[model samples]
Target: MNVAVSNNTTQPAPRVIKHRAWGRFKRNKMAVVGLVIMVALILLALFAPLIATHDPAEQDLLQRLKPPSKEHWFGTDDLGRDLFSRVLYGARVSLSVGIFSVLFNVIIGVIVGSIAGYYGGKTDSILMRFVDMMLAFPQFFLLIAVVTLFKPSLFNIIVVFVVFGWMGKSRLLRGQIMSVKNREYVDAARTIGMSDFRIIFVHILPNAIAPVIVSATLQMGGMILSESTLSFLGLGIQPPFASWGNILQSAQNLTVMTKAPWVPIIPGFMIFLTIMCFNFIGDGLRNAFDSR
Candidate 1:
C-alpha cells in the first residue's frame, strides 16, 4: 500500500494577498475613458475665457434660435446667447460646486465619524441621533427651502449642499471605523500607549480611506446634479453666470423648447454625459477597491 505522498510540500505562503487597486482601475477601459473626458471638460472650463469665441452672457436677439451651423457649432439660444460658450462656462460652476461641496462633506464627516466610532459611548449615540434626525427630512426639498431663504448664488448653493451631504459620508465612515477599530493593529497601537487620536487617524484612517475615496467620487456626481437641479428651479447661480441648469430653465416653455431646442439640448446633453462619466468611473473604483 504505497500511498505516494505528493512531494509538493511548500504551499507558496498565499502570495501575500496584495491588492493593486490602481492597477485594477487602469485596466478598466470605461474608467479610463471617463477620467479622460472629465479631465478634458475641466481643462475646457478652466480655459473658457481663452477658448470660447463669444461671451456666454452676450445676447443678440437678432441671432436668436439659430440652428447649428459652421459659425455657431451648438447654435444660439432664444436670447441668442452663444450655446457653446455657455456650456463651457457652465462647466466651471458645476465642477466647482461638486468639488468644494464634497470637500466640506468629507472634512465634517471624517471628524464626526472618527470621534463617534473611536469613543463608542454617549458621543456615538448623540451624534448618530443627530444624523438620523437630519436623514429623516427630504433632502432636495430641504435644500430648496434653505436656498430660497438665502440669496441665490454659487456660494449659497455650495453651502446648502455641504450642509446636507455630510450625513451620508458620516454614516459610511462610522461603519468603516467600527469594523477597523477591532483589528489587531488598532489594539496593538492602543497597547503601545498611542493616543486615541493617533490610533484613529494614523492606524485606522489610512485603511478606511479606500471606501471614502470611492464614495466621494460618486457623491461629486450627485452634488453636480443637485446644483443643476437647484439652478433649473431658478435658485442657483443666477443669470450673468451661465450654468447648465439655468440654460435648461429657459426651455420650460413648450414653444421655446420646440423653436430653440438647442438651448436646453446642448447643456442637457453635457450634464448627462458628465454624470454618466462620473458614474462609470465611480463604479470602476468601487470594483477595484473591493477586497472580496
Candidate 2:
C-alpha cells in the first residue's frame, strides 16, 4: 500500500447492480413465492410431453366428464381428453404468447420511446402525439377488432397483441428517458463523439430500463389473461389447441357448468395463480429498483 499498489477488489458496476437487485428481491417473501411457482410452471410446461400421462387431444366418448382420479389426475374434459395433459400443453401455448408478445412489445416500445425522448422538440412532439392518440382508443375493443381481421393462431395472437400493447411501454420509457438523457454520463458519451444511436441505446437505455422491466413483468400477466379472454371468445387459440381460455369456454354450457365444474375451475385457478405471481414479482422488482 505504501508502494502505491492499486486496489482491484471492488466489484464491477453491473455486478454490483445485479447483486443488489437480487438481494432486495430475495428479501421480498411474496416475490420469492411467485418466483418459485412461476419456475415450476415453466418447467412443467417445458417437459409436458414427458410428464403428461395422456394425450391432450385424445378423445374418448366413454371417459368424458369424469372427475379427478388416479388415471386422470385432473379428470377428462367434455371431449374425454385428459384435463391434466391439456393443462400442461396449454401452459406452453399461454406462456409462449405472453412471453413473446411482451418481448416484442418492449423492444418496439424502447426504440420508439428512446428516439422521442433523446431528441426533443419536433421529434418528441410528433411521436408523443401519436402515442396519445393510441392511448385514447379503447384498447380492448381495438384488440378484438384487429384480431378478428386475421385468423386465430398463436403467431397471429402475439402479433396483434404486440401491435396494440407497445404504446403504453413507449410512453413509460419516453418519460424515463427524458428524465435521464441529460445526466452526466449521457453528456459524457455525447461529448466523446459517440453516435446518437449508440448514446441513446447504450448509455441512456441501461439507466432508464428499470421502469420498463417492472412494467413488462406486470404486463405479461395481463397478456396471458388477454389471450385467454380471446380464446374464450373464440377469436384466439382455436379448438384442438389446449389454451386455458378455450378450456374455460366449455363452462359456457349449462350442463358442463353444473356437471363438470372442475373443468373450468382448474384453468380458471391456474390463470388467477399465474397473474398473482406475476404481480408479486413486479412489485418486488419495482421496490428493488427504487433508489430511496
Candidate 3:
C-alpha cells in the first residue's frame, strides 16, 4: 500500500462464440459421429484418383451390372464404369452443388433481408409481400419451370436452385434482424454515429446469425437432395458427369432396378447417409446456438 507497487495481473482473454459453440457441439455424440463421416466423405471426394481403383467414366460392357466384389469393390454401373470411382467423383459434384449454391443463396438473402429489416417501413412491407408471393408458389414446380426454360447444365441448375432457395432465407434473416435491431447494442451503435451499414452488418447481423447458421447446415442436405432429384429427372447434371442423382437414374429402369439393385442402392444409401449426417450436424449446431 505504501509503495503502491505494481501487481501486473493480465486480464483473461474473452471467450470466442465459436469456441463455446464447438464445446457444445462436442457434447453431442451423434453429431461427432456425423462430423467424422462427413469428413471422410469429403476426403474421398478430394483424393478420388488416389483412392479410386479405375477411371470413373471408363466403360466396359462386359463388366456392366456386376455386383460388389473384391476386384471391383462397389462393382460396375450399367455403363460398366467403376461404381466406386464414380461414387467418389459423384461426391465431389454433389457437394460442390450443395456448397456453392448455398453460398450465393445466403449472400443474396443477407443483403435483401438486412435492407428490409433494418429500414423497417414501406421497404419492409414491400419486401415481405414479395417474399409472401414467392412463398405462395410451389418451390419444386418453380425450379422445374426455370430449369425447363433453360439448359440442364450444372450452372443453370445451380441458378435455379438459388432463385428458389433465397426466399426462405430472406424471410428468416429479416425476422432475425427485426428481433435484433431493437436490442441495446444496436441502439448504442446508432447513438455512437456508426454508419447504418456498419450498425446493420457488424452489430445486428452477427448477433442474429446463429439461427441462420443452423438453417444453412440443414438446407445443405436439402440442396443435395434437390440436386439429386433434378439430376434423376434429367434436369440437372448431364451425362459424362457423375452425381448421386444421375447414378440413381439407373434404377429408373424396372429391369435394372429389380435385377441389378446395387446400381441404385449404393448411391441411394450414400444420399440418405449424407443427409442424415447433415441433419445431425444441424441439430447439434442449433442446440449449441440456442444454449445460454
Candidate 4:
C-alpha cells in the first residue's frame, strides 16, 4: 500500500511545475537583462518631464544642429528643440502605443478566439476565414489609406494598429483554445454542467493564455516599430508632438546629419534596444513554457 502511494505521488503538482518554470526563467541571464531594460524604459517614459532639461517642443533655430554638450546632452535639432527632451517625450508615445494597443488586441482576441474555438464548426469556419482574409490584405496600403483619410495623431495611430492587430492574436488564441478545449479536464468541466463561460475562461484560459501573453509581449514591440514607421512616413503624429521617428526626421537635412549626427542616432538606438529587449523576453517565455 505504501509503495503504491509513493509511486502515484511521484508526479509533480501543477503549481510545483509553474514554480519550476519561474526558476528556469530566472536562470536565463538574457531575460533578466530584458526585464531590467523594459522597467528602465517605463520609468524613463513616466518621468520624461522631470528628466528633461528643456521642453521637447521649445525649439531655438539659433541653436539648431548643435553637437552634444552639457547644455544639450543629446544636442539640438534643426528647430533647436532639445533632442534628449524629445527622446524622453517620444518614449511616452512609443510605450503608450505599445502597451495600450496590445491590451486592446489581447482582450478582443481572447474573447473572439475563445468563442470561435470552443463553439467550433460553422462559427469557427466563419471567424477563421475572416481572419485569413484580413491577413491576406497588404497591411501597408491599408494603413496609408486609413492614415490619409483621417488626421494622424497618437490616438489614431493606436486605433489603427489595434484594428489590424487583433486578427493575428485571435487566430493565435483560437489555435491554442482548440488544442486546450479537448483536454480531459475540460471535458470533465463540461461533464459537471459548468457554464460555457466558466469552462472557457476559468479552466481553459488559465491553461492556454501562456502563449498569448508571450505573443502580446512580442507584439508590443511590433507596435512600436509600426508607430516609428508611420511617423517616419509623415503619416503619423505630426510635428510639435515629438516621437522617435519624427525626431530622426531631422537628420534628413544634410546639415543636421553632419553637424549633429545625434539627430537620428539616439532615437534609432532606443528603438533598436527596445525591440531587442522585447524579443529576448519573448524567447525566455518560450523556453520557460516548453512542455517538454
What are the TM-scores, per candidate, against the unseen true structure? Answer: 0.91, 0.93, 0.91, 0.93
Worst 10 residues of 3 by lDDT: 4-13
> What are the per-residue Cα lDDT tens digits for candidate 2 across 1-292?
3111211222124556668889899999999999899999999999999999998989999998999999999998888999999999999999998889999999999989999988989999999999989889999898899889988899989998898899988989999999988766666666668999898887678778889999999999999999999999998899898999999986688888889999999999999999999999999999888766
lDDT, candidate 3, 256-281, per-residue tens: 78778888999999999999999999
Clashes of 1: 0
Cα error, residue 144 of model 2, in Å, equals 1.3
- The stretch of ten residues in a row with the least summed lDDT in candidate 4 is 3-12
lDDT of 3 at 260: 82
lDDT of each: 0.85, 0.89, 0.84, 0.86
- Please give the TM-score that candidate 4 achieves against the real structure: 0.93
- lDDT accuracy of residue 252 in candidate 2: 84
- Model 1 residue 75 distance off true place after TM-score fit, in angstroms: 1.0
- Candidate 3 residue pairs in backbone clash: none
Q: What is the per-residue lDDT of model 4 for residues 16-55, given as tens digits with 9 covering 90 to 100?
A: 7678778878888998899899999999999998999999
Task: Return the lDDT, model 4, position 275.
Answer: 92
Q: lDDT, candidate 4, residue 192?
A: 64
